[model samples]
Target chain A: METIAHKAKLSKSSPVVRKYRALIHHQQDMPVQPDISVKHLNKVYADGFRALKDINLDIEPGEIFALLGPNGAGKTTLISIICGIVNLTDGEVKAAGFDIIRDYRKARESIGLVPQELNTDSFETVWDAVSFSRGLFGKPPAPDHIEKVLKDLSLWDKRNNRIMSLSGGMKRRVMIAKALSHEPRILFLDEPTAGVDVELRRDMWEMVRKLRENGVTIILTTHYIEEAEEMADRIGVIRHGEIILVEDKSRLMSKLGKKELRLHLQSPLEKMPGQLALEPIELSEDGYELIYTFDSQQEQAGVARLLRTLGDLGIEYRDIQTRESSLEEIFVGLVNE
Target chain B: MNLYGVRAIYKFEMARMRRTLMQSVASPVISTSLYFVVFGSAIGSRMGDIDNISYGAYIIPGLVMLSLLMQSISNASFGIYMPKFSGTIYEVLSAPVSYVEVVLGYVGAAATKSVILGVIILITARLFVDYDVLHPFWMFAFLVLTAITFSLFGFIIGIWADGFEKLQIVPLMIVTPLVFLGGTFYSIDMLPEVWQTISLFNPVVYLISGFRWAFYGVSDVHVGISVGMTLMFLTACMIAVWWIFKTGYRLRS
Candidate 1:
């Protein structure tokens, strides 16, 4: 980290870089604010294809905000609009207090986007690609900054290699390096680890965590529920072009997540007992097991009451086990609903 | 102006051109030299001068313009089409650089390559045939303007084309045929009176005729008309490109 600061000092005295450095220093002095804000954003295509409805989202500085959605759920579309890759038909987006359109340069300067597509200048060396991207944002050439980004991405050894010669995982890392080349205050990873291997995915998650620790606000879009569960400080569920839910990761899991209690009976029963029928419980198809579904958020899951009621009803159980729904199930449940 | 952005994109494109030197520069130059060898050397030795200059010398400007038009469009179109094909255009579009800067970078690099190729062909033409640029300043001016104008035209085609075949369609089918019919080999007066009037409608006629005048002070059309038509087409292309960036045509989702 000190190496990065040391290299930053070697950059030409570009006001943009200096201002950006000051902004980093300034970030600590102020209260946390949304590094990115989307207000009533609506995107209706010319042919009347509504890709995104009125959407409002805010990403606080220094937090990982995950936008989770199924395919064609407008996750990429919303990100595109904010990044100015796609025009917003109606609504406003601001990056670091600069409106995306009115102050597009400033907005873009503060944001780095790693697109879902593995698009790169195939003939360009990894070093040139990242360095060029930084210059595109009008930042002065900072070899130190570029070197740090390459090192952080574990791409320092491959800096001189052409992009076409790199593996898929390395290409993705190059894309990340290019995005971070300008030291953007906010980074948008549009599906960072879609087709990567487990090892690479773990490495990416670790890298994302490291970026978050360095005060870079991250907003990643992923269809993988586990990814969001593991990485997001806050998660937003988008479906059919609308934001259905946005909440803290832990809060979302505990609130919408369900827990199931299954009792293995000593003897088969033909039907659910009449007394327990009033409760939210069902007899298994085999008639030897009983299952109860309860909200994990409830103060009391009533497990003790359930056990006592089973005793009064002369039911005997060999064993009982409880399971909390994984984020995948919760996500599927939300989408289906 | 986003000068750094322009330079970044420009340098990247020029670097790509370098990496594929055989395809981008060598291929076109060699092919054009073959045209000079076949037409200027063998055929011209049999034919007489068309307009007070040697048959070989007279066709020099036309040949240069022909290759210039095709190469300018080909280089610019393919340069931009590659990014779109690979989906790397999103990086450029999402960058802080404005549309004007993007165009300046890509088209500027394309035109620069075309100009370099044109100069190379001119030098090659001298080795094969004795030709003097009667108006040296106008020769350079016409060469650069034609390169830039056709490059901008190619930029439009790049944006409009969705596939590789679509990219080649205009350069091969339309532009090449137009250049052939635009008095590239012989003066239009050699054609029947009716065909001469029909040939005037082709935009390549004005470009080739104006360029030929710069080399030998002889043209089928007035030099003023040629420059005017070139400027007019350039303005039209600029407007189309401006509209493309404004509406995000074929560029954005």
Candidate 2:
């Protein structure tokens, strides 16, 4: 396994590395407790459609966990069950250390869900709508907290405006404001930036980072792979209602990520050299380039041996470039597998 | 007990009523006042007194009951239905609130609104006729009980309904006709013996009769039976609501 120290040496100032370091330091001081836990959870809809199979997951507090899946991969169903909006068929779910079924009030109180749909009370002022959400979680009226949440979302000026009068992005901000109103310990943002403008999307990402800094655990589902690449500390891929993979972002990249070396030769070769026939390399269609693909995590990458072999064989290369597979490519490969 | 959650839902619904004051409060008040004018003063003055009470005064309880039933169901149904329609009900469903608290907040607000409308219509009726409540305590009791019962009924309708048209189906086709035939403008005693017996089958007859008995100490049926029938309906509505929450019918999947 590649260690965090090894990854840190690769990029000293990477936010993902810094976050993992902070998580390790925090874990050493206190007993580790998952903010959300699922044990063999299963859900089947009324129409006999199995939305979720036996699944298990644990998300640490203050971590940004991203769930990546296709349209019908049951991401929303799992969230709804945890948030107590939908009924689970069997198994157990606990949030903030409370059983979601038995201690539902406490569990739900600790959670704030921003659903994928932009549902709001159109006739209500943004202030009332957000304050109402706080009250719904059984919290006392705290104008200062509401004010802070509004200002953080950049919605203070539109506080008195009816939600129907706001723009689409403003309405999206109102949804986030409402979710944050109660100061929940865990926040589930389901496609938070879907259909939002670029500016609002960036603002949402910043707010999420700030919330994480304040020790709020965030679990988000998104179709945007770049979003997961940008924000998530851990990535989970769900396909056909089953969790296929879960790993630290850096570890996943280092383990599954592949590197390709393309050597542009000075002279075209009709075919591979007889002596180099056993090498894991390929010739370009026009025989102008030599391509070698290798796992990034391998200790002996064989690049030095290949270069020495080229020199011994008098195979001249004018230029060489390497490329690593992106997370999108790895994700697609995983889903297809 | 999520009291704050209940209060939040209650206050939110009440604020919605306030926002549509002209429709929620004024419309019913004006319509009830019109009933007093047309049925109480205009046509009622030409009719003979029944049970030694003025025809106009005799119909006061029935008319109030009519408006109470309609408004209670309308207020509660619309209050809950709008949330479902706007897709905002997910918040209520996911909140740290029990089903009991949810019903208390919604039905409580609806009942409160209907009771206030009942009182306003009563005060407005004083403009055209004079009436007395022989059983003042029972009069208020019936008003509150009927409001609560019908509001619970409305809450169920709101949950059961899938579209706007379904919301009005029960109130328009079933409730309105029942009220019209249940003696809102005339006593059952004024009908033929055959029709009087048939009118007993209508549940609204018992509510109107009990309320009329509170006003004039006379009724088409015994006061105990009227109260019992209303309680029966109330209990049935309670059971239906309990079932909806327990089964998550039309609520959760």
Candidate 3:
């Protein structure tokens, strides 16, 4: 590490090397790396309502992380603590190698938050709002850069329009532009699609993906499970203010996920016979199909045993369908568990 | 605190206030004009004079003070209360704008409105009652000082209140009543000795006296004391605002 630092110092005069150095600092090799790390973070309001309880999470660099939870489930509280917008009752958080309390400026400069509400000054033009956000981070004016952000968010055309004139969706897009103004390494979107129409939702998703492509790590909290399923590289589920699980999306699905097996019967049976009744079978509404729901994580779903019992009961099934559980189901199951 | 942040937020706030310019600019003028008409001409026509000055001339300071206080309180409180109602406080809080920038931007804007209203009232008063400032510099100074002081008080009120109903509670229930009881229309000496002593407890008394002294070179209370009290209030309000911002107060935590 010392030699590498020495070598990098020798090449500082080169613009290419200077840019590389700007991205990362020379530190001794540590296997663990997190763009933002929250350690045992806790938040208790003055009224003694504990909003967050010992929540721990380490968001890796360049991953789109989705924090999924019900309302009042500490998702917003966690985000607020990480952004230094809320005080922590206890614990520590580091963003881009800066402790939030000790080095707030650097920690704050490293992150950008697009809030759920359309909170811009209504009288401000889109241009001034975005540019001023940049200045808040102690950044010098970069009009070309600001113009690019506006264009990317499709806001350049309305740059001069007052915020009050824009619709709810447009105001939300302006929020993303403001959050992006500082060019932070980490971006947080708190319910980025809440109350937004379908068209603007798609635009915001694409814009967020583009930001991620530019190497900005994105952390988003959403009540919509589909958003996390579609956009996130990793999923973290918080329940009752505690992080229950955080895992790679695919790996988690394969590990603790479930699949439902459905069987349609040829005959409409008013009631299940004794043999089949002993099995975990749910009858369909029309009395023509028998549904069997079991945890896929179990070593034996007892499909063979159930099949033997169905044969004995003379239950016929010409068609069979299998469905895997969705992230919604997974989330509900985890929260329940 | 930050140049770009302050300018950006300030420009945004100023623009928001300008959108409803008719209400902000016209209401104060009309309200003050009524005072000029009723109190200036009607009362002055009957009473003749006080302190060798016509009743019309005696009320000019009151009219200007009345406009300045109303504009200051409304401008400062609304500047913040709307954002809070709109749920945009989080955006501003999360943004790069420091708390100082946020408070100062609103207070400064409110003060701007107060100053403008004060000027309008002064000009309007001249049309009814003939009065000249004993010292124009002190006149302007007193105008700015009072504006800043009350705007800061309004800033504190904005942060403390949560809703539109709560926002108006302080100004309507407290400040307006004090303005009327602050000897705006008459000298406190005219009151019984017990009531005269009670009037000193009202902070608005100092503000009205200081402002009246600037225009007439006469005051019920000591000019130095009024200015000193305003300074004390200004410093105390600033400290409270700064502390709130630093601790996040009702804003963050």
Candidate 4:
């Protein structure tokens, strides 16, 4: 009921709803529409395996959204459906206000997809591949735009090089250049950094930020929690073919984040105190330290109580510090449940 | 009809062919020349003539048609199958191009390559033996019609095939054997009446006979029947391609 209520409120302000209201009010103002909207989307493959279930997502213009999921969590399936590459079994998708099914050409024209695979035209020069991709979208030749894309990807030096001879990182960049060649309003990157080296990953993240700055809405799916932590404005987690949670990146971290209290003991003990054993506290190996875990959302009153109890039990700590849980931990916990 | 999309895909496929020039153009041309040398010049001379035409000139249309059929199918099937194998087809699928544009791009390029090969084979045959084209315009028409028809057939094969070996199965086992037995080397009239009757059922027989007719004004089947049959086969292949795209068979998941 709560979920329904939340969505109801959201729809009232949603791009579709706003557009409806604008039409009713005869307002000349063109409200900024969602870059992409997926409603109650479900996918069941021919083999009787369900890949996505009741997914609803709305990406605002220019927002960088990150989709995090474990393997087989339908991240690619969701992206594929929106890109018009995979047909949806149920529900509807709209990209830049065009229905993905009914207005497929228009919808696809507004979107770009950089797939996980490093598939390229091995015999063509980098310039031709990107130019041809833009042409495939029915866009007129814009050599300047192609040159800019190649330059932005640091591929200007190798523009004339055959795709087969470029390094793996460069090949991936060429894919990005191709995806961006048509100057799509929405971009979907499926595991863009998967298997990429650290330097290239950093470069790609920087490029994604720049693209967002230029008003391109970017949605990338990755298993790397840190990538989401560093990039996403909003983060969504998917598990077992279901989207379990979606929240502001900071909000999700703070809501489920835990702070660990670690103590270094002056004197070693063989076992944890019985009074503290039931209090979510554990004695470390060699009995030199004790650790306590608690929700960061809660007050620190429990910490003072734990300290007082330690004093009463004649347990002394040399030093203590608290560390908030990282997004990786929170992600693992969410999927594990 | 997204001409730009068609042009892009067509140019891409053509570029790939240029990169593998030896295999795509040279090999087919060289092999056809060998057939002319062995079958037309050497062995054909001993067999004399068929239908008042020298044996070498008699086999010119047959040999050209044989390569055109095989090359058209092989080029198109391989062109599409490679993208599928390399997983690059997703880009094409995700683009704004419709299925018709995709077919036009691929099949058009394949047909163009086959026609070029047919022309080369015809010129190469002249170097070995003298042959006269009775109807020049009709000869060009038959060349293009056959190339386009077989290229569409090859596009279907590409979609149906999943493996590298499967890509070759139809062109090698089915198409080549049909051409060989479809009276490419000898006129079906030379066989027993029963054998000739059986040969009439082969589709390749109509293609070769029609092409042979364009060259010498002599054919086993009527010119009208050959054109009708080619159009019918082309329509069937086009329908199969349409169904493949509509159903997203072997393409979408």
Cα lDDT listed for each candidate:
0.87, 0.89, 0.80, 0.87
DockQ values per model: 0.77, 0.89, 0.35, 0.81
What's model 3's lDDT at A67?
A: 88
Q: Which stretches of candidate 1 lie over 4 Å from their true place?
A: A1-33, A263-271, A283-289, A299-301, A311-320
Clashes (candidate 2): 0
Model 3 CA deviation exceeding 4 Å by range: A1-33, A118-143, A160-167, A195-199, A259-323
- Per-residue alpha-carbon lDDT of candidate 3 for residues A165-212, written as tens digits (9 for 90 to 100): 998888988988988888989999999999988888887788877776
Compose the digit string of candidate 1's lDDT tens values, residues B1-253. 7999999989888888898899888888899898888888899889988988888888888889988999899989998899899998888888999988999999999999999999988998888888888899999999999999999999999999999999899999999899989998889999999999999999989999999898888999999999999999999999999999888899986
TM-score of chain B of 3: 0.96
Q: What is candidate 4's lDDT per residue for B1-253, written digit by digit as tens?
A: 6788999999888887888889998999999999999988899889878999999888888889889999999999998999899999998999989999999999999999998888988888889989999999999999999999999999999989999899899999999999999989889989999999999889999999998999999999898998989999999998999999999999987
- Which 10-residue span in candidate 2 chain A carries the lowest summed lDDT? A2-11
Error of 1 at A51 (Å): 1.3
Interface RMSD of each: 1.1, 0.6, 2.4, 0.8
| TM-score versus the correct structure, for each prediction | 0.91, 0.93, 0.83, 0.93
Report the poorest 10 consecutive residues by lDDT, candidate 3 chain A.
A1-10
Residues A1-337 of candidate 2: C-alpha lDDT, one tens digit per residue? 4211111112223364456446645665555557788888899998899988888888876788998888899999999999988999998999998999899999999999999999999999999999999999999999999999999999999999999999999999999999999999899999999998888888999999999888788999998888888899888888888888777777788898888889999999999988677878999999999998878876265788788899999999999999988888888988887
Question: In candidate 2, what are the lDDT values of residues B64-100, reduced to their tens digit?
Answer: 9888999999989998898889889999988999999
Q: Residue by residue across B170-230, what tens digits does model 3's lDDT show?
A: 7788888888999888888789999999999998898888888888888989999998999
TM-score for candidate 4, please give it.
0.93
Error of 1 at B212 (Å): 2.2
Fraction of native contacts (fnat) of each candidate: 0.86, 0.94, 0.40, 0.86
Show model 4 residue runs off by greater than 4 Å. A1-32, A265-278, A304-318
Select the stronger candidate by TM-score from 3 and 4.
4
lDDT of each residue in A144-239, candidate 4, tens digit only = 999999998899999999999999999999999999999998899999998889999999999998887677788999878899999887777878
